[model samples]
Target chain A: MRRLGDRVGMAWAWGSSLCLLLGLGTLLVVLVTRGAPAVGPGLLFGDTAPGDAVLGRAPVFDGIWPALMGTLALVALACLVAVPIGVASGIYLAEIAPRRRRALLDIGVDMLAGVPSVVMGLFGFGLILLMRRTLAPSATTGLWLSALCIALLVLPYLIRTTQTALDALPESLRLVGPGLGFTRWQNLRHVLLPAAGRGILGGVMLAVGRAAEDTAVIMLTGAVWNAGLPAGLGEKFEALSFRIYVLAAEYRDDMQLAQGFACAFALLLLTCGLLASAHLLQRSLERRWKA
Target chain B: MSPTSGRTRGERTAELLLAGAAAVSAAAVLGILVFLAILAAPAWQGAAHVFTWDWRPFHGHYGILPMVVGSLLLALTALLLALPVAIGIAAFAHGLGPRRLARIVLAAVHAMTGIPTIVYAFVSAMLLVPFVREVFVHGSGYSLLSAALVLSVLILPTIVLVVHAHWHSMGKELERTCAALGIPRGRAVLRVLLPLSRRGLLTAAVLGFARALGDTMIALLLSGNAAQVPGSALDGFRTLTAHIALVVATDTQDAAYASIFAAGLILLLVAAAASLTARRLGAGNGRTEAARAAPR
Candidate 1:
C-alpha cells in the first residue's frame, strides 16, 4: 500500500511538471505566431509619423522606434538611479548594518517591492507630477517622474540581489580586508565590490529588464501613445509596453494590433536576452566561486 | 583615525553616504503613504458615491465596491488554480525529478519570472481569450476566467521558485530516514515534505495572490473592462488596477480622480498586508534562504 501511494504521488509530480512545460510552451508559441509576422525593418526604424494623417490619407505605416527609444531611455536612466543606490543599500545590509537595522531595511524593501505598479503610478501622479507642476510648471514633462518611479520599482530587486551576492562571498575575505588595516567602507569598496562585480552586473541586468517592461507606471507618467522621441528630460515620452496596452485596448484593426504584436516581440526579446544573461552570469559566478 | 587622514575621511564619507542611500528605501515607503493619504482625503468625508456599488464616472457616481470585488475575485481564483499546480512543480523539481531535468526546470522557471507582465497580457488577450470564447459558447472570452488563467500562468513561476528554495533548504534528513525505513521517496515527499513546508506554501500563495491583484496589464487588456461585479467566472469585470490605470489617465482634477486615488490606497493596503503576512509567516518558517527568495 505504501509503495502504491508512492507510485501515485510520483505520477502526480511528473504530470504537473509536464503541465509546467506545456504552459510555457503555449505562451511562447502564441507570442511567436502572432508577433513574428509584424517584425520588419519598417517596424524597427520607421517613425511614428502618421503619414496619412499628415498627407490627408489613411496612415501607411506605424513603427515602434519612438516607443522603443522611450523604453531604452527609461531603462538607462532608471539603471543609473537604481543601480548605485541599490548596491549601496545592499552593501550596508551585508556589511555595516546592525542586525535590527537589517531587519527594518528588509521589511521596507519588501513592502516597496510589493506595492502594485498602478499604485506607484498613483504615487507618481500625486506626489512628483503634482509637486513638479506646482513648484516649477516647466518640469511637468513627466520624463523624470516616470524614470524615478521605475527606479523605485526596480530598486528593491537590485538590493536583494546585491545582498545575496555580497553575502555569498567567503567569510575569510571579510577579515582579509580589515587585516590590511582598511576601514569598513574601504574594505568593502576595494575588496567586496570588486569581488561581487559580476553579481552586481546580473542584478543591474534584471533591473534594466524590469524597468523596460513596466507599463502602468509609465502610463500615468505621461508616456504618450505613438508619439515622437522625447526632446528633453522634461518632455513626455512613449514606451513599448504602453504601446502594447494602447494597441490592444483601443485599436481593433489587424494592422494596428499587428503593430502591437511586433512591439511585444521586441520587448520580449530584449527582456529575455537580459534575463538570460543575468542567469548565465549568476551561474558562471557561482561555479567559479565553488571552484 | 586622524581627522586629516584622507583615506579615513573618504571611508567615513562613503559609509555615511551609503547609509543615507539605504534610508531612501524607508523614505520611499513613507512618501507613498503620505502622498496617498493626502490624495485620498476627499473620499473619506462621507461622499454619497462612496457608499454605492455602481461606477458611472460621467455622472460622477463612483462607488468602487464592484472594482473591489472584481479584483478579489480575479486574485483569489488565480491563487486557487495556481497553488496546486505550482506546488506540484516545486515538488517535482526538488523531490522527484532527476538532477538534469530539475536543472532545466529551474532554468525555465527563472526565465519565466523575468518575462514582462505585458507579454502575458498580449499573449492572453490574443490567444487565451479567443480560445475561451470558442470553447465556451455561452460567454465572451475576456471574462474573469480568462483573467484568472492568465494571471495563474504569470504567477506560477513565482510560487515554484519560492517553494523550490524552501524544499532545497529542508535538507537531506528526510530522504536518509526514508532510505533507512524502506519507504519510497515519493511517499516521503507526499507525506513528509508536503506537511513540512506548509508555511512556505502559504507564503507562496499570498505572494502570488498579491501579484495577481496588483497587475494592471492583464486586468486592463483581458478582463473585458466591465466595471461591475462579475456574476460568474464567465462574466467580465474591471479590477482596481485597471480602474486606476484607465480613470486616472482621463479623469483629471475631479472627485473621480480622488476616488481613483482612494482605490489605489486600497490596493496599497492589500499588497502591503499580503507581503507583511508572508514575511511574518517566513519568519515562523525558520528558513532564511527560502524567505529571501520568496519575495519575487
Candidate 2:
C-alpha cells in the first residue's frame, strides 16, 4: 500500500512537469506558426503603417521599424539613467554603508521594486502633472518621460544584482586595497570594480531586458499606436510592447492581428536572445575566473 | 599619520557622489508615495461614492469595489492553477528527472521569466481566449478565466524559480540524509520535502499573486472590462490596473481622473501588503538565498 502511494505521488509530479513542458511547447509553436509568415523584411524595416492605405487600397507594406527604434532608444536611455546610479548605490550598500543605513536602503529598494508598473505609470503621470504646474509647463508624456519611469522601474534589479555580485567577491580582494595604502575609491576603481565587472554587466543585461519589455509605464507616458518616428526626446514614440497591446486589443483586420503576432515573436526573440547571451557570458566568465 | 589626512579630495568627492546615488533610491520611493498620496488626496472629498461597488464613470459614479474584487479573484485563480505545476517542476529538478534533463528544464524556466508579459497577453488574446470561448461557449471570449489562464503562465516562472531555489537550498540535505538512512527517494520528496517547504511555498504563492494582480495588459485585454464582480470564471470583470489604464485613456475629467489615483493607491497598498507578507514568511523559512530569489 505504501509503495503504491509513493508511485502515485511520483506519477503526479512527472505528469505535471510534462504538462508544463507541453504548455510551453504549444505556446512557442503557436507563436511561430501564426507569426512567421508576417515576419518578412518589410515587417522588419518597411515604413508603411497599418493604417496607411491609399484611396481604399490596402497599404503595400507594414513595419514596426518606428516601434522597434523607439524601444531601443527607450531602453538605451533608461540604461543611461539607471546603470550609474544603480551601480553606485549597490557599491555603497556593499562596501561603504553602515549596518543600520544598509538595512534602510535595502528596505527602500525592495519596496520600490515591489511597486507595480501601473503604479509607476500613475507616478509618472503625477510627475508630469506637477511639472506642468511648476517646472516645465510643456511637460507631457513622451520618450524622455517614459525612459525616466522605466529607469525607476528597473533600478531595483540593477541594485540587487550588483550588490549581490559585489558581496559575493572574495574577502581577500578588500584586504589588498588596505594593504597597498589605496583609498576606498581608488580601491574600488582599480581592483573591486574590475573584478565585479562581468557581474555588473549581467545586471545591466537584466535591466535592459526589463526596460525593453515594459508596456504599462510607457503606455501612460508616451507610447502610441501610430507615431511616425521619434524626432525628439519630448515627442511621442511607438514601442513594440505597446504596439502588441494596442494591436491585440483593437485590431480591425486579420492582417493587423497577424502583425500583432509577429510583434510578439520579435519581442520574444529579442528578450530570449538577451537572456541566453547573459547566461552564456556568465558561464564563460565563471569558467575563466576558475582558470 | 591618520588615515583621514592621507585621503585625497577626489576620493572624498567620489564618496559623496556615490552616497548621493544611494540616497536616490530612497528618494524615489518617497517621491512615488508622496506623489501618489498628493494626487489621491482629492478623491477623499467623494470618498463615500468612490468606495462603493458601482464604477460608472460617465454616470458620475466612481466606486472601485468590483475592480478590486476582480483583481483579487483573477490573481487567486491564477495562483491556484500555477502553484501545483510550479512545485512539480521544482520537484522534477530536485530529483525526479535525470540530471541533464533537469538542467535543461531549469534553464528554460529561467529564460521564460525574462519573456515580457505583453507577449503572454497578446498570445492569450489571440489563441487562448478563442479556445476558452469555443469550448465553454461563454460570454465573448474575454472573461476572468481566459485572463487567469494566461496569467498563470505569466507567473509560473516566478513560482517555479522560487521553489527551485528553496529546494536547491534544502533538498541537498534531505538527499544526503535519505542516502545515509537508506530511505527511498520518493518517500523523501513526497513525505519529507514537500511538507518541509511549506513556508517557501507560501512565499512563492504570495509573490505570484502580487505579480498577477499588478499586471495591466492581461486584465485589460482579456478580462472584458465589464466593471462588475465576476459571477463565474467565465464572467467578464474589471481589475484595478485595467481600470486605471482605461480611465487614463478615455476619461480626463477631474473626478474620473482623480478616481484612478485612488485606484492606484489601493493597488500599491495591496502590493505592499503582499510583499510584506512574503518577506515575513520567507524570514520564517530561515533561508536567505531563497528569500533573495523570491522578489523576482
Candidate 3:
C-alpha cells in the first residue's frame, strides 16, 4: 500500500510537470508559427509603408527598425540610471547596513516588486504631466519619465540579486582583503565586486529583459503609435511592446497586425538570446571561481 | 594604536550612508501608497452615488463597484483553477520525480518566471480566445472565462516556484521518519508534509492572487472591454486594470480620468494588502519552524 501510494504521488508529480512544459511549449509554438513566416530582411528593415492595404499585399512589412531603436534607447537610459544606484544600495545592504536596516530594506524591495505596473504608469504620467506643465513643454518629458519609471521598476530586482551574490562570498575573502591592509572601499572595489561580477551582470541582464518587455509604463509615457521616428529625447517614439499592443488593439489592418506579431517575436527572441548568454557567462564564472 | 578607532569611523560612515539610501527606497514605496490614497480621497469624499454598480465613465458616474467585482471575480477564478495544478507540479518536482528529472522540471518552472506577462496576454488573445469561442459556440471570444484562463497560465509559474521552495526546505529526516513508520506514502505526505507547508502554500496562493489581480494586459485584451458584471463565465466584463488602461489610452480628462486614478488606488491597496498578509504568514511559519527545532 505504501509503495502504491508513492507510485501514485510520483505519477501525479510527473503529470503536472508535463502539463507546465506543455503550456509554455504551446505558447512558444503558437507565437513562432504565426510570426516566423513574416520574418525577412524586408520585414526586418523596411519602414511601414501605407501602400500595402490589400489582403495579398505584403502587409505593411516594414521592419521593426524604429520600434527596436526606441526600445534600445529607452533600455539603455534606464540601465544607466538604475545600475549604479542599485549596486550601491546592494553594497550597503550586504556589507554596511545594520541588521534592522537590512530587514527594512528587504521588505521595501519586496513591496516595490509587488507594486502593479499600471500604478507605476499612473505615477509616471502624473509626475511627468506635472513636470511638463512646469518645466519643458517639449516631448522629452515622456521619454525621461518613462525611463525613470522603468529604472525604479528594475532597481529592486538588481539590488536583490546583487545582494544575494555578495552574500554568497566566503567570509575568508573579506578577512583576507582587510588583513592585507586594504580599506573597506578598496576591498569592495577590487576583491568583492570582481568576484560577484558575473552574478551582477546576470541580474542586470534580467532587468534589461524586464524593461524590454514592459508595455504599460511605456504606453503611458513614450508610446505614440504611428508616430514618425523620434529625433530627440523629447520627441514621441513608439516601442516594440507598445506597438504590439497598439497594432493588436486599435488597428484594423491585418497586415499591420502581423507586423505587431513579428515585433513581439523579435523582442522575445532577443530577450531569450540574452538570457541564454547570461546563463553561459554565469556558468563560466562559476567554473573560474572553482578553479 | 588608533587603527581600530579609524576602522570603526569608516564603518560608521558607511553604515550611515547605507541606512540613508535604504530609507529613500522605502520612502519611494511609501510615497506611491500615499499618492494613491490622496488620489482616491476625492472619490471617498463624493456622495454614495459613486458606489453605484453602474460605471458610466461618459457621464460623471465614476462608480467602481462593477470594476472591483470584475477584478475580484477574474482573479479568484484564476486562482481556483491554478492552485491545484501548481501544487501538484511543485509536489512532483520536489518529491515524486527522479532526481535528474526534478532538476529539469524545476529549471523549466524557473524559466517560466522570466516570460513576460504581455506575452501571456498576446498568446491568450491569439490562441486561447479562439479555442474557447469555438468550444462554447454561443459566447464571444473575449469573456471572463478567457481572461481567467490567460491569468491562470500567467500565475502558474509563480505558484509552482514558491511551493517548490517550501517543499525543498523541509528536512530529509521528517520524510524518512514518516516512511519508516509504515505509514502509507500519500497519507504520510498529507499528515506531515502538507501541514508543515500549509503556511507556504497559503503564501503562494495569496501572491498568485495579487499577481492575477494586478495584471492589466490579459484582462484588457481578453475581458472584451465591456463594463458589465459577469453573471456567467461566458459573459464579458472589465477589470480595474483594464479600465485604467482603456481610460488612459483615450486621454480622457473628465471625472472619468479621476475615476481611473481611483481604480489605480484600489489596485495598489489590494496588492499591498495581499503582500503584507503573505509576509506575515511567512514570518509566523518561520517562528513555528524555529519552535519545532528548539525541542530537539
Candidate 4:
C-alpha cells in the first residue's frame, strides 16, 4: 500500500509536469505559426489607414510603428526616472542604512511592489487630477504621466536587484577602498559600482521588459488609439501591449484579430530578446568576475 | 580616517542625497495609499450601499458586492487550477525528472514569467473563449471559467518559483538522508519533502491568489464583464480590476467614476493584506520571501 501510494504521487508529478510543458508548447506553436507572417517592415513601420476600419469610423488595424516608438520612449523615460533613484536608494540601503531602518525600508519597498498595477494607474490618474488643479491647468493623461507611474512601478525591482548585487560583492573589494584611504563615495563610485554594473543592468533589462508589457497602468494613464507619434511628453501615446488589448477585445473581423496576434508576437519577440540577452549578460559576467 | 567616522563634505552630501532617495522610494507607497483614499472619498458617501449587491451606477445604486464576489471567485478558481501543476513542476525539477529535463523545465518556467499577461489574454480570447462558449453552451465565450483558465497559466510561475526557491533552501541533505535510510524516492518525497515544504506551498498559494486577484486583462477580456455574481463557472461576472478598467474607459463623471475609486481602494487593501499574510508565512524563510518579491 505504501509503495502504491508512492507510485501514485510520482506518477502525478510526471503527469502534471508533462501537461504544463505540453500546454506551453502548444501556446508557443500557435502564436508563432499564426503570428510570424505579420512580422515585416510594413507591419512594423506603416500607419493604420482609414481603409483598415471595420465597424467603426476609426481604423481597427494598426501597423504599430507609432506604438513601437511609444513603448521605447516610455521605457526610456521610466529607466531614466527609476535607475538613478533606485540605484541611489540601493546604495544607501546596502552600504549606509542603520540595521533597524533597513528592515523598515525593506518592508516599504516590498509593499510598494505588491500594490496592483491598476491601483498604480489610479494613482497616476489622481496625480493628473492634482496637476490640473495646481501645476498644469491644462494637464491631461499622457506620456509623462504614464512614464512616471511606470517608473514608480518598476522602482522596487531596480532597488532590490541593486541591493542584492552590491551585497553579493566580496568583502575584499569592499575593504580595498577604505584600506586605500578612499571615502565612502569614492569607494562606491570606483570599486563597488563597476563590479555590480552587469547585475544592475540585468535588473534594468528585466524592469524594461516589465514596463514595456504593462497594460493596466498605461490603460488608465493615457494609452489611446490612433494618437500618432507623441510630439511631446504631455501627449497621449500608443503601446503594443495596449494595442494588442484593444485589437483583441474590439476587433470586428478575422483579419483584425490576426493583427492582434501579430502585435502579441511582436511584443513577445522584443521581451524574449531582452530576457535572453539579460540572461547571457549575467552568465558571462558571472564567469568573468568569478574567474 | 575610518569609513564610519567620515567628516568630508562630499561624503556627507552623498549620504544625504542617497538617504533622501531612499526616503522618497519608501514614501511613495504611503503616497499612493493616501491618494487613492482621497480619490475614493466620494464613494464613501454611499457607504451603506457599498456593501450591498446592487451596482448599477447610472441608476444611483453603488454597491460593489458583486465585483467583490467575482474577484474572489475568479482568483480562487485560478488557484485551484494552477496548484497541482505548480506542485508537480516543483517536484519534477527537484528530482523526479532527469537532470536535462530539470534544466529545461526551469528555463521554461523562467521564460514563462517574462511573457506578458496580454499575450495570455489574447490567446484565450481567440481560442479558449470559443471553446468555452461551444462546450458549455452558456453565455458567450467570456465567462468566469474562461478567465480562470487563462489566469491559471498566468499565475503558474509565481507558485512554482516560490516553492522551488523554498526547496532549494531545503537542499539535498534530506534526500540523501532518506536514501541512506533505505527509503524509496517517491515515498520519501511524499512523506518527507511534501510535508516539510507545506508552509512554502501555503505561501506560494497566497501569493498566487494575490496575483490572480490583481490581474485585469484576463478578467477584462475573458470574463465577459457581466457585473453580477456568477452562479457557475460558465456565468459571466465582473472583477474589481476589470470594473475599474471599464469605468475609466467609458465614464469619467457621476457615481460610476467615483465607484472605480472605491474599487481601487478595495484592490489596494486586498493586495496589502495578501502580501502581509504571505510575508508573515514566509518570514523565517528568507529564500521564499526573495522569490515572492521577484518581479513577475
Tell me the DockQ of each model, to 2 decimals: 0.59, 0.59, 0.34, 0.61
What's model 2's interface RMSD, roughly to a tenth of an angstrom? Answer: 2.1
Give one digit per residue, the lDDT tens place, for model 4 in A202-283.
7788789889989999999999977766557989998889999998878876656777888888788788777766676666
Clashes of 2: 0
> Which candidate should be chosen as best, given lDDT against the real structure?
4
Docking class of 1: medium
Better of 1 and 4 by TM-score: 4
lDDT per residue (tens digit) for residues B162-276 in model 2: 7776676674767889878988775787778888889789888888888888999888989999999989989999999999998887745777777788899888887778777
lDDT of 4 by residue, B19-137 (tens): 99999998898888888888788777765366679977766777788999999999999999999988988888877777788788878887888788999999889888998889888
**Candidate 2 residue-wise lDDT, A95-158, digit = tens:** 8999999878877777777788989988888888889889898888899989999999888878
Write candidate 1's Cα lDDT for B1-296 as tens digits: 76546366667788898898889975687689778977788788867375469788778788889999999999999999888888877878875887788777777777777788888888678778999999998688889999998888888887887777666667788788877898667667788888988887888888888888898989898999888999988888999999998887775446787778889989988888987998898673433333223332
Query: Each prediction's Cα RMSD?
Result: 3.4, 3.4, 5.6, 3.5
Query: Per-residue CA lDDT of candidate 1, range A146-263, in tens?
Result: 9988899888878877887787788877898888887666778788888888887888888898888889998988798755665567788878898898887777677677777777
TM-score of every prediction relative to native? 0.93, 0.93, 0.88, 0.93
Please report the TM-score between candidate 2 and the true structure: 0.93
lDDT score, candidate 1, position B204 = 82
Q: Can you tell me which runs of candidate 1 are displaced by over 4 Å?
A: A1-4, A47-61, A136-141, B1-7, B284-296
